[model samples]
Target: MSTLNKVADVVPELLIGAAVDVVVRGSDSFIGDVLGVESRYAQLGWLAAINVVVWIIESASEYAAGVLWRGLAQGIEHDLRVEAYDHAQHLDLGWHETRPQGTTLATLNDDVNQLERLLDVGFPAILQTVLNVVLVGAVFAVASWQLTLYAFLPIPLIVIGSLVFQRRLEPLYDDVRERVADLSGALSANLSGIATIKSFTAEDRERDRIAGFSIAYRQANLTAIRSSAAFVPLVRMAILAGFTCTLLLGGWQTLDGDLELGLYSVLVFMTQRLLWPLTDVAEVLDLYQRGRASTVRILALLAVPVAVPAGTARLDKPVGGRVELRGVRAGYADGPDVLHGIDMVIPAGETHAIVGSTGAGKSSLLRLVLRFDDPRSGEVLLDGTDVRELDWDSLRGSVGYVAQDIYLFSGSIADNIAYGRPDASQADIEAAAEAAAIADFVASLPEGYGTWVGERGVTLSGGQRQRIALARALLRDPALLVLDEATSAVDNETEAAIQSSLRRAGERCTTLVVAHRLSTVRHPHRIWVLDAGRVIEAGTHDELVAQRGSYAALWAVQTGEATA
Candidate 1:
């Protein structure tokens, strides 16, 4: 019914178009008779006035419908694109990991545009074509039933042909849409990894990959085009067949005096006016099928279930950031548990670190703390409350996470710093930057805080971006701060600066650090050593190092010892 309301927006145009056909045909018949009569001047004046009035209505209605439909298309496009994006945002990290960014972008942009095109042109064309048939057929039925039969005889064939074309075109259109998504994905990957491609001198390889996707896209479109191209000619032939029958049969009746000349003129004019526009219906139907295919894809994306639903409970007070994981077993889909029966606790305002080798699931533990994914067994708690029972927004608001691979949005430096706290003042922004040891670097830039970071913060070096991300987390002033290899990209001086800042910040909130650089974790209140997804050791840095275990071995490797 909402879709029907959109059709109503163009109803005036449909009505005027049908009315214009009637007026033009009726006036032409009247002109022949008025010229044949004695009072030709008076009749000509009246006919001229009627034609002018109808033309004004036709022109005004066409303009109004065009404007209205475009506005409606833009509004719908905005809503659907936003809704798809918001839904995707709420989905679990695991879900995002399995989906390609380019495919998701194509669904949001290309698919929505397809529907917009249908609204802009296809919907109005269909409505007007329908009005022409029904209204013109009614006018013919009243004048002569035999002529109506001849006029509408080929309509069924046209409809049958349209259906056949639509049926064949649907799968091909679906193929076209899929191929476009594939091409978009390939293009996005190649563009994003252009630096890597150049370093490896693999431009030709990447270009070949993109070319294959492009060729597939072209072939899919060609297949759909081949079928769609056949339709206009078929509709024209159907229109010709109907028009020819009406002309020959009506002309014979008129010459034999079985039908009046004025009626014959009107019938001939209406037949051409009504059925000829059906030729355009082929293009309209093609637009509709393509739009329908795109709609299906968009709806499928919207239908993806949110694996991690948000909780409704709000905290009685602000969270104090005491986090605990109780026998929490979790993993990716169809994979063994990354965190197997892990039981741990971090008291409020404590600083702890987790250090492990590759595939030891160090980062996975932090993800659980953030509730990016729920445990397959047991529960994660925040401040003695199960995280699954806490309001997700409240839980998230009380925690700040800095990932290993920092992603800075395309915006000013101030914008990126204030991303987690949009309403932060300039002083607060500068203070956070200073805390992250990035204030001097920012101030040195000509644009300073106003500097625009290119897409993915390409304007900033890796260490700078990491510092900016830390500043963003600091701006949030969260009760719990999780840093995953936060200083990995920075030089030792910057790392020392960040570590100094963290030492001060850790006194105010719980801090969990996942670091490969042993220097960062050496002073933590406690260190957890992970081996094969299990916590094998937990103690203060000195205790763990003295134990001569996994943590001791890792420290020896980092401290330049010859052997464990």
Candidate 2:
């Protein structure tokens, strides 16, 4: 349906190109007759009058066509970009993790722009060439069929050459598109990791790496260039052959008195009009191949299945946040299970902590609750309703998640805090910041809440970024709050303060924390000890310490009684 709308948008502009060809060729015939008239001054005046009318119509149509076609291309590009982004946002983390950010950006920006360029230039060029052929060929036939027949001698060769050109250009242009994506990915990665590269003194190494990718991109373009360069000249030769035959045959026929001088002149001009536009046929085909390549990439991305489909159900009211994982088994898209058949339940309005060794799937548990990655073998339920059966917006909005890797967009601190709840008032934003124990630090800044955080909160400390993320999550006033190493960057004193605040906040919300430091989890309502993707023990911190098992062993290590 959208394709039809897009074609409709561009069709008028194309038809105008055909109309312009008629005016151009018709004026040529008029001027040719004026040149032969015995009343030269009178004929010249009439020719001037005809010129003014044709110019007015031609200029108006040409200008409107350019404006209308460009507008159509822009609208399509905008829609495509938004569709790609909206689809990407709904995909599961597993899908996002498998792809490069650069590849996605390249498809959204570069590939979409390529198609736009095709529409802007290529579409009109093709229309003009076709119109010239059809309109001029018909006019030539009427003037003299013999001359028209001679003019078509090179048509078969041009058609065959174009077919061969397209077949060969497809793969070469596809390669060029792939190389462009690689270059985009490499550049994005380097820019994001510039600080790391500088810290490690790997500037030269990174430069060389980027240069290699650049060379590959250039080479791909050159290969396409080599092929395209050969095309226009060959097409021009075919065009020249047709033009020469018409000129010779029509001139001979005119001298032999078989053709009128005025009619012969018109035929000769029409033949030039038909054949010269073929010289640019190569450019039109180049755009076609490049646009075709980009369209394939864009379509491929759109076709990737949404890993987490939004369900049709909505909550009658807000959920009470009772989360239960029933015999849940889970894994990444391409990996073995990270969370085994783990059955657990956290009652509404309770705080629970998950502690495990590195790679013990402590974080994975929180992800399951948030539905970042779904369980493979069992359902994750919230308030007795399977999360998959709930509307994704309602399920996600009811949970406030803060991960170990904090991401704060470039904006004022207040804006970042209010990101999850854009309608939050200044007072509400400040209250959430206070609850997260970040209000004092924010108030100390020169701009207070208005201070810019820079890209990814680079102006602030890691601890500050985490606090801002927490404040953002807190602003939602979610029924369920999930923190995965949320306070890992804060100092011991700040951690203690935040933990105390969290304890008070948990009274109204269900809190789940993946803890690295035992002290942080010790005061939670319940604590679970995970080992090798299995829940080895579940109880209060004191209960597990009494058992003197894995939890106790970890506590001992943290307390300096055993080696980690």
lDDT tens readout by residue for model 2, 375-410: 888989888888888887789889899989999999
Considering only N, C-alpha and C atoms within 3 Å, which residue pairs clash in candidate 1?
none
- lDDT values of the candidates? 0.85, 0.84
Best by lDDT: 1
Q: In model 2, what is the error at residue 388, expressed in angstroms?
A: 0.7
lDDT of 1 by residue, 1-564 (tens): 222333333333333433443344553444445455334444545556665665666566667777887999889999999999999899999998888888998999999999999998898778777877777787689778999998998889888888888888889999999999999888887888889999999989888888999999999998888889888888888889889988999999989988766567667778887788788877898899889999999999999999888888876566788989899899998888988999999999999999899989998898889989999998999988888888777799998889998999999999999999999999999999999999999999998999999988998899999999999998898899999999999999999999999988898889999999889888888898898899999999999889998888888888999464
lDDT of 2: 0.84
Which sections of candidate 2 miss by over 4 Å? Answer: 1-39
